[model samples]
Target chain A: AQSVSQHNHHVILSEAASLELGCNYSYGGTVNLFWYVQYPGQHLQLLLKYFSGDPLVKGIKGFEAEFIKSKFSFNLRKPSVQWSDTAEYFCALSGGGNKLTFGTGTQLKVEL
Target chain B: EAGVAQSPRYKIIEKRQSVAFWCNPISGHATLYWYQQILGQGPKLLIQFQNNGVVDDSQLPKDRFSAERLKGVDSTLKIQPAKLEDSAVYLCASSLVAGGHNEQFFGPGTRLTVL
Candidate 1:
């Protein structure tokens, strides 16, 4: 069965630190990738998405993800993190269907 | 534009009891989705609707779970004889289009606790 894997379960970092959350999916062929963030007490919102474009895609809130098709990976990156960036992040893939499959979330804790 | 809306922010019920959750998608949205998020896990898609018709429900446990989208705007998800494993956050989302690139907008989920 197709699945998504998130390498980090939880991460802690000080403010202004660079961040990278790993995401990989088990699928061959075409796929649509997405990154979503859920802040404390807020609903999940789309941070970015990738679909038949340049491998590198930029998203809201200074977030970006690189879709490496060879590795089946789409890793999220942020050059500088703020305390407000602390939240749960999820990676998802939509392929050939209406429903999307999500990876286990990564919880990032940014300390000031 | 208003995001998706869900009712009964929380629900608790005894095992074997039946319960239902409601959702209202954004105006002009052509697609709606329901997802189940267990503690410490990613949200899993349970159903997808295009207008009043279901587009995909392959992951839904049809044995006991049922959902409906009336008037192609609002929806309801029901579970008969709820089980303990059903305890989780039920999320509702909607998108303007059904194509692969459309991003979904989510609502505040209904946290269900099946005791």
Candidate 2:
């Protein structure tokens, strides 16, 4: 059985502040990693994904994440944040087929 | 392209009652999935279907939870004699293919509240 973990349950940041959300999964074989964002009252949207490319990937809305295989981490990061960035972030992993395993999620609150 | 669609934005049911959630995936998608999302936790995969065939359902509690995707277009998730544990958002997702390259498109989800 595979599982995903997100250490940060809640994160608070101010405008223009840096942001990072920790994500780690317990899987040994080949895996596809993804980060999804959910705005208040909205569905989950893909922020970024890492299938088989550079460890560093950039996504919509000025979001990026680095995949550190050694640590089993795919941390989401943003240099400067805005109030619009306030949303719940989820880390997911997929293998075999379309089935994905997601983390507990981290709720982000960005102050203006 | 249209994203996944789920009906019954909210559902309230008493214990031991039965409920069903509907989902319409993106057109031509080859794979579909249903997930249960508790209030705080992440979405948990309950069932997987590949072109109208069951691919993986190891996590689905067959004792009460059941799902089907007939003709491989839209799908439905049902829970008979529902329990409190089943009170959560039922999220339906779909992908262009079954492989790892494809990303899933999600629906608004149906919020089920079991008393």
Candidate 3:
């Protein structure tokens, strides 16, 4: 079965620290990748998405993700983080269907 | 550009009880989805609807769960004789279409706790 894997369960970082959340999918076909963020008590919001074109895609809130087809990886990255960036991030994949398979989310805590 | 809307932010029920969730998708959206998000896990798709028609429901527990999208605008999901394992957040999301690149706008989910 196709699945998504998010390597980190919990991550703690100081403000202005660089962040990278690893995501890998187990599908070989054409896939659509997405990163969603959920702040405390807030609904999940789309951060970035990758479809066809360039491997690197930028999204709202200064978030970006790179889709590498060879490794089946779409890793999220941010050069600097803020305290308000504390949230739970989810990696999802959609291939050949409208359904999305999501990974166990990564909880990030940013310290001041 | 209003986002999706869901009612009853939270609910607590005992096992064997029945509960229903309501969702109103964004205007002009043709595709709506319901997902189950267990604590500490990512959201899992339960059903998908397109213009009041069922598109995909392979993951839905049809034995105990039922859903409907009347007029293709508002939808309801019901679980009869809910089990303890049914406790999870039910999320409603809508997209303009079922395409791969269409962004899905989500609503604040209804959290259900089955004791």
TM-score for each of the candidates: 0.97, 0.98, 0.98
Stretches off by above 4 angstroms in model 2 are: none
Tens-digit lDDT string for candidate 3 (B22-51): 999999999999999999999999999998
lDDT of 3 at A112: 96
TM-score for chain A in each prediction: 0.97, 0.97, 0.97
Candidate 3 Cα outliers beyond 4 Å, as residue runs: none
Q: Output the worst ten-in-a-row residue range by lDDT, candidate 2 chain B.
A: B95-104
lDDT of each: 0.94, 0.93, 0.94
At residue B70, candidate 3 shows an lDDT of 84
Pairs with backbone N, CA or C atoms under 3 Å apart (clashes), candidate 1:
none
Q: Chain B of candidate 2 versus the native chain B: what TM-score? A: 0.97
Worst 10 residues of 2 chain A by lDDT: A92-101
Tell me candidate 1's TM-score on chain B: 0.98
Residue pairs clashing in model 3 are none
Query: Ten consecutive residues with minimal summed lDDT in candidate 1 chain B?
Result: B95-104
**Retained native contacts per candidate, as fractions?**
0.77, 0.81, 0.75
